[model samples]
Each structure stands twice: as C-alpha cells, then as structure tokens.
Target: MQQQTSNQATRRGPLAGVKVLEFAGIGPGPFCGMLLADMGAEVILLERAGGTFASQLFGGGRKAVANRGKQSLCIDLKHPDSKALVNRLIGQVDVLIEGYRPGVMERLGFGPADCLAVNPRLVYGRMTGWGQHGPLAQRAGHDANYAAISGALDTGRRHGGAPWAPPTLVGDMGGGGLLLAWGIACALFEAQRSGQGQVIDAAMCEGAALLAHGLFNLNAIGAWDGRCALDTSAPFYDVYPCADGEWLTVCPLEPQFYAAFVERLGLAGDPDFAGQQYDTARWPAQKARLTELFGTRERAYWLEVFADTDDCVWPVLSMDEAPQHPHNRARDSFVEVAGIVQPAPAPKLSRTPGQVQGEPPLQGEHSRAQLLALGLSPAEVDGLAAAGVIRCAG
Candidate 1:
C-alpha cells in the first residue's frame, strides 16, 4: 500500500525530529508510545506477528484509538533474522520504549546490552510493574498490585473498609506509562550533551509512591490521618448526590473558600459551623449537614448557584458530559478524530505544540514501506514476507 508518512516531518512539536521504536505491549507501553507520537515523534510500533493484541476488548485486528498517531510494522521476534532487522531499526531511532516483564527484552535480544551495542546514543526505556530489580521484580503483578504495595492504596481508605480502586489510571497509565515517557524525554535531552545512552527502570510501584510525595510529609507529622483524607469525611471536600440523581463535587479547602461556601449556604452564623472549620471534631456534623443540604437541590441548581464564583464546586461529569462542558468547550479539551471523540494532546508548547498526526494504523500497514526505506530491496522484502520473517499489509 502507498504510505502517507512522507509529510510527517511538518508537524510543529518539540519532538518533531525525534524517532521512537515502541515494542508492542498493552496499557502503559502503548499509552507512552501514543504520547511520543502525538508530540510529533515518528513512532514505529513493532507489533508481534500472529498474536492476539488484547487490552480492554481490543484484539484480533481491531486497533484502538489509544494507539493513534503511529506506524505499525509486524515482525516475528523469535525468527533467527529478526535481531538483524531490529538492530538496523535500533541504529536509526533515538528512543526505544518497551513494557515487558523485567527480563523479557533481554531474553528477546533487545536489552540494553544488545541495542546499545548497535547504537551508542540510543535511550532504552523499560516499563514494568515492580521495576528492573527488587525482591518482587519478577513477580506477577498489575496496576492495583503496584498501588497496593506502594502504600498509595493504604492512605485515604474508608473508615471501616479497605476498598480497592481499579488498576487502570494510577498505576498503568500514570506510574507505568507516563512516568516512563517522561524519563525517556529527560534521557533524550541529556543524551544530546553526553553522547551516551541510559536505561530507564520505571517501576509502577515506585512511581505510585513518588506520586504521593506530599502525602508522605502529611503522614509524617500525624496531621493527615488515613481516614481524614477521605473526601466523604470532610464537609468541604466531598461529592454529594443531587435531587436529580446526579452528582456534584465540592472542594473548598482554604478558610476563605470555606467561609464563602458557608455564607452561600446560609450557615455562616451558625454556632456549630461558625469558626471550627478545621476542627476534626466538628467535621462529622458539618458533613452530614452539607450532605442533607446539597441533596435538596438538583445538580443544575447548584451549578448555576456556584457559577461566576470560586466556590470550588462543580458537577461530577461523566465521559460524555466532560467534552461538552462549558470549561472544556472553552478550552477545547477534547477533539474528534476518525469519528471518535477523545482527549486532545496536552501541555501546549508556545512555538511547537504537539498534535494528533494521524489515525491508528492496521497491523503491518507500513511494513513494506518501512523496510524499503531501511534499504531493503523489494525482492528481499518479498522473500522475508514469504518466509514469515515479517508481516506486510496490502
């Protein structure tokens, strides 16, 4: 198939000239690759041949929007000649991101020792749940497991129960993928000056702990008890149900904001809530009163009441509502691509803002063109395809 990659260099992002080779994986790995691609990096996804790529019901020839803005080239890594092909690609790319278990990449001959041998300036990024080394480095774990071990899950638990959150956001995307991406960017910048490549051992467990840095100090002083951190226990920081069955969240943490909130609710002069806003002893009564009061009105009423004010209150919008909300609309926080609505590229740069360069690709969609650009003869490419060493899509 004729490719559309010739014009990719025209994008105006900081990483416009960068090249990334993303070894196919799920969750954090793909998300990291997507971030790099969205920032105008030329990312080539090296997908495995004849494998079901399942992550959240997306598998068996169905590509996800999360994988957008990248080119896909399917290759059999177990093939004897695959190392040669990978080494060639390694020599060309500046960054390589892989999210496998601790030693999987080394076992497949794409480890730091192997790739850095081919390209001395290559930045090797490794994403894993437990990181590269530790007691549980090779243990089977997921996002929730990482959060649990990192002590993130222990803080802010409900009074009588230890509820576990889903494994998607905090661990996989935040700690696992996004942390790895940032480390790669830092290494890329340093590589320019040092002319050396380094390995990024990003463990979700450590990343999760890192995310709770401020909370650690709070815990140290005994000021932030685990239960007190829960929004439900605080009058000023909790989500309340509305009369219309919708939800709205409030977070007037500062004294000034809390005073404004209380005044607006017509409870400013009440003895029970007047000057003891920070008293943990009065929190339960205040929270109960606020809950009862907020439930008397619909979300629309509260939104209108708090409009044009810094009450620190807003509706708890779902995915469908968020894109159309006034703030999001004014900021253009979401965009439509290939008929699918999703979040836009973030943290705009003044001179070289990133963009969604293209839609997600079908597996092996650019294999022939990629191989040809790598100086492989058409006959040689065809022979490799015929021998099942590589996969190409028409």
Candidate 2:
C-alpha cells in the first residue's frame, strides 16, 4: 500500500513528502510535530485510547499551538492490533517523535532500537527536560524548572522580584521543542547520506543553556557589570510606562543610536544624559529621568517621535496588539485559523513557504479515514472501534 500522507488529499510546502508519527504526550513533542506539519510533512498524532482531548475543542479558546495540519489517531497500545499497527506505521514514516521520559517508550516497545529495527531509516526524536541519560532525566520538570537549572532564569531576574517567566516559551518551546525539530531536520539530512537513522536526545536543559549563549559575554568581558547597567539593567535598554497606561521599550545600544535617541527625546542638551550615556554611575539617574519623561507622554506620542528613525524605541505590545500592528501585518506574521488568530509558520522559505493547514484535530477525528488509508477494511476498522482499541469520530 502507498504510505499514508496528510489528511488532506495532497501535502503542501517544503516537507511535502516526509511522513511523521507523533506519540501523543504533551509539551515539546507536539510543538516539534507542529513545525513538521507546518512545513507540509504528513504528521499523524498517535493518541492513547480513552482520552478526551476534544473537551478542549476550542483548545482553551484559541488555536492550539503545535497541532495544526495533522491527524489524531486514537490507539490503545495495549491492544493486540496496536503492535501490528505501529510496526506498519514505523516502516512508512520518515521520523518518529515522543516527549515521554526515556523509559516510557521503551516500555511501550517503540523505543529507538525498536523503531529503527522496523525501519532502519527512521529518525527518532525525543524531547525531555533533562535528557535520556542524566541524573534528572527521570525527574518531572516543567519549562521554568529546566530554565532555572540551566542558569537562564537568573539572567532574567525582574528587578528585585522573581525572574520574568514567559510561560513555556523559553524551555518548552524554544529549548526543548524547537531544538527537537532542528535535531529531526538534521537527522533526516544525515540519513540521506548514510541511509541510516539515529536517535536525537534533545533536552530542555541543554537547549536553555544554548539559548543563553549570549550571557557568556558577562564572563568574557570582565569590566561589564550587569548590576551597573552594562546589560539588561542598562538605562537605554529598558521598558517604560507611558501616560496612557501603555508601555514602550528602548534599546539604543550603539553610540549612534543613543545619540539619535537622546536627540529625539530632547535630552541632548541635558548634561546628565549627553556625554554620560555609557557612564555606569549615571545609568540609575538617567533611567529615572527617562522614566519620568516617558511617563509624561502617551505611547503613541513617543512612537511617532521615533517612527522614522532607528532609535530603537517602540510600543511594548501585547499578544492581541501584535498582529494588529502595521509591521506584523506587512510581514504576515500571524494567520487566522478556525476563526482564531495565531502566529504563522516562521523563517519563511523563498519557494515553498509553510502555512497553517487547519485547526487542531479532535481526538480520533481521523481514525477511520487514516485506518482505511493504511489498508484496513471498514469492518476491521469498526471491529477495532467496537473493541475500544480505537475511536472513530461519529
């Protein structure tokens, strides 16, 4: 039988011919699958039986991230049919993704060795917080925990309070999930040359450390003191609140940009601000002065003042405000799917840009259809559903 493709009649985008099987878990695995599906790979989510994902039909009232352009197949891996089914799938798919702790998939009989035994060329991508062989590998950890242990958390301390947490973007999506996708892509490329596949041990801790690569400059440059405003604490690289209760962020790091920023803000004549731009002793006072100045005007007023120049000052927009902005609209940075606005596929390709194929699938929504494409008869599909080994959406 021909290998199963996307639920749609024909796949689209740069990865049109690739096939992936994603073991349903949560977090980073789904995100990696999302990237593959976005690029037009045929990604099928292997959900466990008895799960009710459609309860989140609206997916928390917005588009579910990392689940677009894929089909969800509810499979009871404990059932006899499951072994046959997964073995068949492993033979056809180009990659397999799972975000479980190291031993879970091995216990399920779909570990890297198990899958590679079935398909020598299948890339096995695993995403985890610590990794497959570390001391904390089996320990439960969320994004923030991993980021904290990786030393990224300390670098982002918000004044005297806790470090600013961006939900799961840093550790889960950026470090774990995005790195898993990159690992899979790299593995696939290497497979082309060697005709063999391997396991990718993508851990959030490692990825988080990599994400904070720039922080190494603190140690490399001995004179730079973060508390003295040489880094994020810098007066020029701060966010300020405006009169209208909105906010603006500035990052005039370069001398030229600082000049433009100082001139534009009418602070060029102020002795405390002019030649003292980089004086560590003056940063606190200058920050206070700019804070007061920015508080005097609305965000829109300051936006217009530096709109034509690269003074590095702009509104600090929220999620809803971002897509509505002119620059985002011009770049098509976000797209609408199922009447919900969400970010679009990024780092667009020149010839075959990725796109949002569809909304997140209902659990077992494509069970019957995918089974049929896998060469199962209608009666066989029904029998499996009747046995509670599978679910086909009514």
Candidate 3:
C-alpha cells in the first residue's frame, strides 16, 4: 500500500473533505480523533501549549497510535487571546470534539453554546465518563469505573469470580470514543440537510450500557442466568489451558457443531458427552471432563485436530502472535509505521477504503503552518508563540 501524508488535498476516503478540530485529551478523546483522521478527515489536534498528560505518560509522541493522521497546534486555552483564535478556527471546521468534564469547556469559553454561536453548522461532540448532565457527571472516573457503574463489567464475570474487564477496550474505546465518532458522523449527516449543527453528549458509562444491550435482553427474558451456554460455565463454550500452557477457545453452540466437537473428541458414544448441548444440570461434570481431556494435549495438537472441522475450536493467540496468524496476514489486519506495528484501518470499503494518513505528530509540530492557514500573519504567530499563548516546535 502507498503511504499517505496528512495533507487534506491528498486524502481519499468518504470523509475526505470533512474538517475536524479536536481539543487534545487522553483516552477516548484522542481515540475518536484518530478514528476520524483514519477516515481521511482533516483533523487538527489542538493540544495544550506545553504538553498533554498522554504525551508525558507515553514519552514517545511520534509513536502514539491514537495521535496519528493529525496536525498538531499547541495553544493555551487559558490565554486571553485564545478564545478569538479558537473561534476563528471553529468558523472553518465542521466538527469539534472535546473530552472534558461538563463545565471545563464552558469555563474555557468554547462550550457548545459558545462555539455554535460562532458557527451554527459546527457539530460539537462532548465525551465524558458519566455525561454532560447527570448526578455523577462531574465526578472523577475512568474506564473501569464507567464499566462497573454501567453494569457492563458485572455481566462478564463468572458465577463466583470477581468481575474483570480489559482496560480501555470496554469503556474508553468501545463505548466512549467509537460511540462519539458515530454520533458525530450522524450529526454531520443531519447538518448537511438542516444546515444546522447540534451537540452530542457521549458518556462512557452510557456507551458501556448500550454495548451490553444483547446481554441485558437475554437476562431480562430469563434465558440467561449467571451460568449459561454463552458464559464460561458451559464446557463447550469456554477457553482452556493446554498441556503446553497455551490456550484454546472451544465454542460449538449449535447442535451440528456440538456433534462435530464430540465426534472429533471420540466421545460420541459416551452418554455423559452425547446428551443435549444445553443440559445445564450436566455442565459442571462435563466441564470438568473436558478440562481434563484438553489438558492431556498441547494447543497445537488440538489446532491440528480441529483445523478442518466445524467444531469451532481455535488457538487464543497473544498480541505478538496475532499479526503473524495466517488469516490476519492474508487480510493485512496489521500495518507497520515508523518501525511500530499496529492495527490497520478497519471495516474496509471497496472503493474508498480508509488509510493510515501519516505517522503520529508531536505537539505544536504544525502550529505555524496551521495558524497561517487560519489567516494569522507570520508576525502575529511569532508574537503569540513568544508570549507563551502558543507553542511552535522545530
């Protein structure tokens, strides 16, 4: 694939001409910006004048995958001249994203009401752990907190085991960032017809809850208890450690698939394993038997055993092992950028597939050029940089 730069004119996706201004932040905010940038939006990351908590934490700004495909402009929102500078830029951009507490943007004078006054067609997307207006909206929280409060984390726990969710993936990226991006896209679409933009309140807690809708429906219908066929309590739909310490995921929910699984294991004649798939009363003993049976073989042995079967058993590859998997390699599921291996753009479109526009940028790396494009004179830009209202990197 040909490498593409962050130049807007050279972008080639469905969002090629869309303009987005992101108030730089950690977690979901940056992730949402990266999503839009990957879709060929002209995303201008308005970073803090000095640095961001993410930059300090990661220490390698150029390798931060979430910051890819963006031009950075570092500005002090607290500076007296900042409001005018930002409002001017807002007039030109189609979307504005910020992930701060409810009142922080209002305090900075760039709130939805404020920015919409300058540009009525601007889509203002606000991301938070709670929401813009709620009892816990102003409270401090993180991904785990959001997942826990939204009931998403609890549902994933085993019958007696404590709930544990993968950090960021459950709440931040899946709920907060991705949901906000979809909301922004919907709002942008509506704006094209109405010629008016609106604000999107994207809360991680709410997003997490939305993500668990299917589970919620099942639970409400009494079809799913704490221990069901879908959960790990069942022997057929669970992960087990092999003799080699590697793991395999075994899931055969359908009757035909279950037949294939038991037949492959040479247990088709055994009454203990040949019964109905959803025989809940026998799950515990069956799970124990399968555990012992799987432990007798290496993961590679099972992989070869089920390679051509519809038994739905496969290896659970680690992060380092995933990129080299045959299916992932065939699909180009990962890409290398500046010696760093990361996931490629997803949900491929046949005509205008998304691309990684460029490498991650440093704070203020494009400040001078972006500011000049906003119609600021070079002298004024230099003066603002000297006054510490803006930062310019070499």
Q: Give all TM-scores, in the order shown.
A: 0.94, 0.94, 0.97
| Top candidate by TM-score | 3
As for TM-score, the candidate ahead, 1 or 3, is 3
How well is each residue in 25-119 modelled by candidate 2, as lDDT tens digits?
77788889989998888899888765534334325212555677888888999887788888988898999998888899999899988899999
lDDT of 2 at 347: 79
lDDT for 389 in candidate 1 is 89
Per residue, candidate 1 scores C-alpha lDDT tens digits across 216-296 of 877788866634534256778887899999998899888788888888889999877966677878887887888898889
Which scores better on lDDT, 1 or 3? 3
TM-score of 1: 0.94
How big is the positional error of residue 79 in model 3, measured in Å on the Cα after superposition? 1.5
Error of model 1, residue 100, in angstroms: 1.2
Clash count per candidate: 0, 0, 0
What is the per-residue lDDT of model 3 for residues 1-394, given as tens digits with 9 covering 90 to 100? 2233445448878888999999998999999998898888989999886577777775546778888888888998888988899888999999999998989999899988899999999999999999998899889999999999999999777666898778898899999999999999999999999999999999999999999999888889997775677768788888999999999999998999999899999998887876687888888888888999999999999999999888999899998999889898888888876567788887788998888888888778899999999988999999999998899887
